[model samples]
Target chain A: MSPNVKHRERNRRAARWLLGLSLVAALFFGVRVGLDMVYWNDPKHHEQQLEPWMTIGYVARSWMLDPRKLRDALALEPVPDRKTSLGHLARQQNIDFETYALRVMDVIARQKAATE
Target chain B: MTEVALEWLPVYGLPVLVLIIGLGCLGAPAPASLTLLICGSLIAAGDFSGAQVYVTSLVAAIFFDHAGYAVGRWGGARLAHWRIPLMDRARHMLKTRGGMAVFLTRWLLAPLGPGVNYMAGVVAMPLRRFTPFDIAGEVVWVTLYLGLGYVFGSYVSQISEVLGDITGFLAFAVLAWLLWRFIRSDLKR
Candidate 1:
């Protein structure tokens, strides 16, 4: 075979391998996207995980609690600002963040029990 | 670092966003998208105003993109002088397709955005051309993620995961198509 023919053959083989790899990758990610969308849309997965990043309002919305009710339940004296996160609040109050988070969680649980 | 950035977001607000988004634009491994999503949720929760988040993030992204470009231009100045065929082809590709590359990578193929910025600079793409596309793409990126977070609220993490997968899928699908095209053209030749 001429050099040009050999070069074309090599390019053809490389393209086939690359295309095969790309197909596999595309399929994998496509399947993952579908699975994630299904998982995300399920009501069972709707429960929000409470974290240090959550503000009072975020927690209130996530748990379907009235923001005013949560504020009153937490007895945030002077009312923590709208943007104040539970972790930041804990820091200001000289409490460990986990302890403060647990306290907030407890408050939520009790409030849910009362409403139910 | 991602967790620390997320945890500090509510405490520090826009400044945290500004810092992370800027760093992400400059090719840092920051969770800039997640920050934007959480900020959108915060906006929904009334912790932040939409205008502030939009304006701050857009500016930070554009500013840092230019900063990345400047770094690339400065650092790659010597490399640009090399007469490699690959470099020449890359320069040609950037001249022809750099706008679309800049725009798509900004939002749709976002993981490549920083690298594209650097490459555009290395190829000495015109600033005037780069700026408009960069701004347009960043606007779409900022708006899309923030909008999803705002609308989805508590599901932001899951939404992020799904969006990430979709981006991966699109990238690989495009690669597959390009490879197929190359094969067809090679056969013709």
Candidate 2:
């Protein structure tokens, strides 16, 4: 084959490989997004893992529960800094992390039940 | 500053992020990757959803990539009059290598982002050829930065600061080297 023909052939092969890779990526992202959406929509998924390090602010926003209501129900001090994780606050207030997790979990469970 | 922005994210939400990223892709000086990283940290911290942050940043980046492409498309030959690094080389790559050039620059030498977008337009790369590679490249960029933030959420503030300092120093070093090269070339001539 001529040099020009060889170059064109190489380009065509590259394009084909790119197209195949792109299709695989699209399929992967689609399935991942679908699974995430289903997981997020299911209330049970929220309770699956309640880590001590999670913040009150994070929990409120994720569950669509009111921060003020959740705090009050849990009888917690005002957390002005949203980044303050539950584990840190529990230590500061001399409260057990497990107790903190359980209280927040209870509130989350109640909120989910009310919505359903 | 990243902390301040992170704190505001939940209050301001996705619109702010989308706007900033769009502007950054259009050649505006903004901390686009840093913003994605912060969003990722927030998602990992449970302050925001991972899917939402990913989707928002992707759309904004791709939209602005198109805008930059449009500007290049409209400017055409006139863009060649402007001085930019690797302009001639980029034009050649776009012509010879095609969309793979677009894909590589999207994540690799991301600082040259706007330059590549504009060059693609100036060279009249077809929209069909540009869009797919652009989207795929953006996915890699978004996911990589976000994943870093998610895994290192607790240490993100320090990580961003260190990265920022390094980026600034590198940019200065590159510019100084380029200036020196230009002067040497002129002297040689």
Candidate 3:
């Protein structure tokens, strides 16, 4: 109700958000010891392995979302393990080279749709 | 210029490397001027050639400064999420001190360029307001270092001795700050 309460509340949210972010960054960038501590197995190293459902999450995390869209997208049920992780899918079919190729094509199609 | 030490360490050696690694060493425990001064000492002590060390250190300094700048831009508003209290302190410092924060970060504290860049971005400071000061800081900062090194080239040892003392103190200060934060945060939790 008071300004002090509001300021404290805001700072508390900021601190909590920052703490979560640090843990995520630490996990991605590796441990405090050194860069060497970031194992090859770390998920960040496998960024290209992202799946379709995960894009919403990544885009959301990147703060590129249009507010409610991200939350709503993520809130929906995940579409099962369509193809393991993007890792196995890429290995099996080179999705980056293939699917990404098609996604570019899809953009063109969408562009055509927009013009019409 | 020291040839004897360069033989063992190859690009002048480990102290320089560690210095760079310390916060990527781009600027370091002090200002860019102090870095050049310390490198000059290695030259005077016959540790490495002053010119060669200067060139390498300069390249590293420029590269990292710009790199920090670019990365700072990439994170922009997200800098607040960094959780580095120094950055938060810097943000508050900039808010109060205004342009003076840029000068101090570039010189006094030496965390100005990248650290302040991100803080500025987070606060959404105008790029115009940011660039000229940054360029001025870099140009002036660079000139001061190289000038100091060249002027006192012969007395590099004295320069290094003084810088080494200051760096040691700053290093301890940094470690103490980190330890303090760790303890304080733990207490907060």
Candidate 4:
């Protein structure tokens, strides 16, 4: 085959492969996102059980609360930096994180009520 | 620096993200994946929607992947033909396992992704094989970082820092490996 003809043939094959791969990738992304949405919307997934190792940043994300506001509401000293997990903060304050997490939940409840 | 660009993410938006990632893939010293993670953080913050960021990032990455490949084809191949130790080893890697090398560099060792793209081109890996695997690898790379950003938006800065360190360490490790291999081969001869 002429060099030009060979090049054209190669390009066509590559294009076909690209289309196939794109389709597979699109399906994978769609399924993953769809599943995450479904799990999030399910009320069963709303289990509010906070673990000791969770950070205020994490709680804010899970609970859809504002991290900054949560910190201010809890009057958390020295500000809750990203690396500071809840368990460490609870220890600093001489309380178990369960009690501390409950207090945060209560604050979130009051804030919601005030907004409502 | 990648972190500095990140601070401007809220102000500058998607175009900036796309540009930085493209250039970074072409051997620019920007932390591309970390930027994606920050973009994910923005998605979580509701500044840009997930689909929009995902599409933009994927296209940008794939576009640059091809560009780097082309660079390797035209530019890097010349060096591969020379008696260079590093180039020879890279050519060997591309010859032995081009697709898996492409995939691994694309996501797992992302800092090396661009270099691999260029090297794959230098070794004349078929575009039919290279492009599809490049896309698949990018899917994982983009999704993982963006997912992290979405889930851990509040801790994005810290995550960026950690990932940057990991990329740096990996890059260093790769360089060290190349140097060691070169010395060992020299001693054998």
Candidate 5:
């Protein structure tokens, strides 16, 4: 065989490494879909549970869990009843509109959690 | 995009095309790591099949990365004459940070990987100097994301949870470290 043919053969051999990577990709996509189906159907695994925004809100709420405890952090008075309507609580506090909005959402989440 | 479009062959094929096109145009402006993470999860769930797809992707990424490094390696003969618009910042980044910047962008965040190559090409960065860094970066990138896919098995939501845990740990560490530093600095001052 000519040098070019030999060179081409060498390249082919080296490229075989990609075959393994291809298998992995196949497995990845295959398994991923299966897991999603299971997760979507199962109520306990949180597969299809909350919307994206709700998850973010949940995490944000955890960050400010102790709003009233920390002297350095923003210290807002806790709503007297976790079940109180957010609109009513916001109106009573006279807080900034943005602040009230977020508080109202959190308050609603708290109320919703209580009922659940 | 539709789920069908995201099949194994296309994922692998597109990047290879990019590599064949000589990588300068293909290398830059790569997608974010989150996308790969998303893929990782999908793979685990058994949503996609085709080993050829990932292998193609890996090879394409490495190939393009290398091509970019090569273009950069060759002194500015091509770049100075090339008529690319609004790529000064990237070109500047390539110059100042050198191979470290290239490596990091390729390995860490990833979006910048191809862009770094283009910039290096624009300025005529030498191929010899660009090779090692590009190689290392590709290895790192492949290992991290591909490994994540292998281990986690691909379910976007599950991977999201893992991501959440990582984010939480980093957040807590940052907060604690800052608090400690603030106290110590205040006492000294």
Candidate 6:
């Protein structure tokens, strides 16, 4: 084949390869979107998982508890003007964040149990 | 980096938010949408004010978009002598579908927003035209992500993941379509 014809043939092959790659990527992300929808839609997923970054107010909202009631239950000091995350609360209490989170989670569980 | 930013958000608040949005708009990799989602959750939890987050984020996005555009305009002039095929294609796309491209990239295809801004400036899309479409699109972008977070406060992370996947799917779908068209045209030739 002439050089020009050979160049055209090569371009065609490259274009087919790119098209195949794009289709595969589209399918991968499409499946992920489907799986995420299914997982989040399950009733068990309705409950928010606690994270160290969450503030007391955020956790209270997630758990459907009154922030003040939750704070009083935790026996935390008066609310500071600035919003404080669970990590910050742990630091002030001189405890590890995980331990502090567990203590807070226990209070939440008890409160939920009482309400039920 | 995202973890650190999320942790600092409740403590540092708006400054952190502004920095993230600004960097993201300037084509730096940042989780601006996720931050906006968390801001919505924070507002719902009463740690932040809805109006404040909305206005601050919107302003920051627009300002940084303009900054990206200015950089593109400056650099594009210097690079004008170079005959880059990709630049030519981008210029043609802007000429044909500038408004819709600007609008869609702002929200529905947010990952493309910064690049579109630069291309729009590189092609010298009128500031008058660019401003209205940009502002309108940003309004939708800010409101949609933040509203979802507000309405589904506890599910912000899950929602972010789903949104990311959806965006990726759509991007690849479009790429596939364009590639198919190119192949067909080449075959015909």
Best by DockQ: 6
Ranking by TM-score: 6, 1, 4, 2, 5, 3
Which CAPRI quality tier does the interface of model 6 achieve?
medium
The ten-residue window of minimal lDDT in model 2 chain B covers B166-175
Ordered by lDDT, highest first, the candidates read 1, 6, 4, 2, 5, 3
Model 1 Cα lDDT, one tens digit per residue, B34-108:
888989999998888899889999999999999999988999898777554335645876899889888998888
| Model 2 spans with C-alpha error above 4 angstroms | A1-116, B1-6, B80-89, B161-189
lDDT per residue as tens, model 1, A1-116: 99766755765686789799989999999999888878867889877667767888898887888988999888775454766777677888899878888888899999889889
Give the per-residue Cα lDDT of candidate 1 at B85: 36
Candidate 4 docks with a DockQ of: 0.03
Residue B27's lDDT within candidate 4 is 80
Give the fraction of reference interface contacts each candidate recovers: 0.78, 0.04, 0.00, 0.00, 0.00, 0.74
* lDDT per residue as tens, model 4, B28-126: 987687778767866665556789889999999999999999998998756667544445666776777788878877876676787788888888889
Best by TM-score: 6
lDDT per residue for candidate 3 within B112-141, as digits (tens), equals 355555566566555566656655555555
Per-chain TM-score (chain B), model 3: 0.50
Candidate 3 per-residue C-alpha lDDT over A34-78 given as tens digits, one digit per residue, 9 for 90 to 100:
343343337665322222212222223232333234333323334
| Candidates arranged by DockQ, highest first | 6, 1, 2, 4, 5, 3
Error of 1 at B144 (Å): 1.2
Report the C-alpha lDDT of model 2 over B1-189, residue by residue, as the tens digit.
433443345556688688778877987777777777767767865677889888989988999999999988887778665443335434665777768767866665465578779878997888889999999999998998889888766544445545544334343343335444443443344
Tens-digit per-residue lDDT, B104-136, candidate 6: 888877767887888788788889888899999
Q: Which of 1 and 4 is the better model by lDDT?
A: 1
Residue A52 local lDDT, model 5: 21
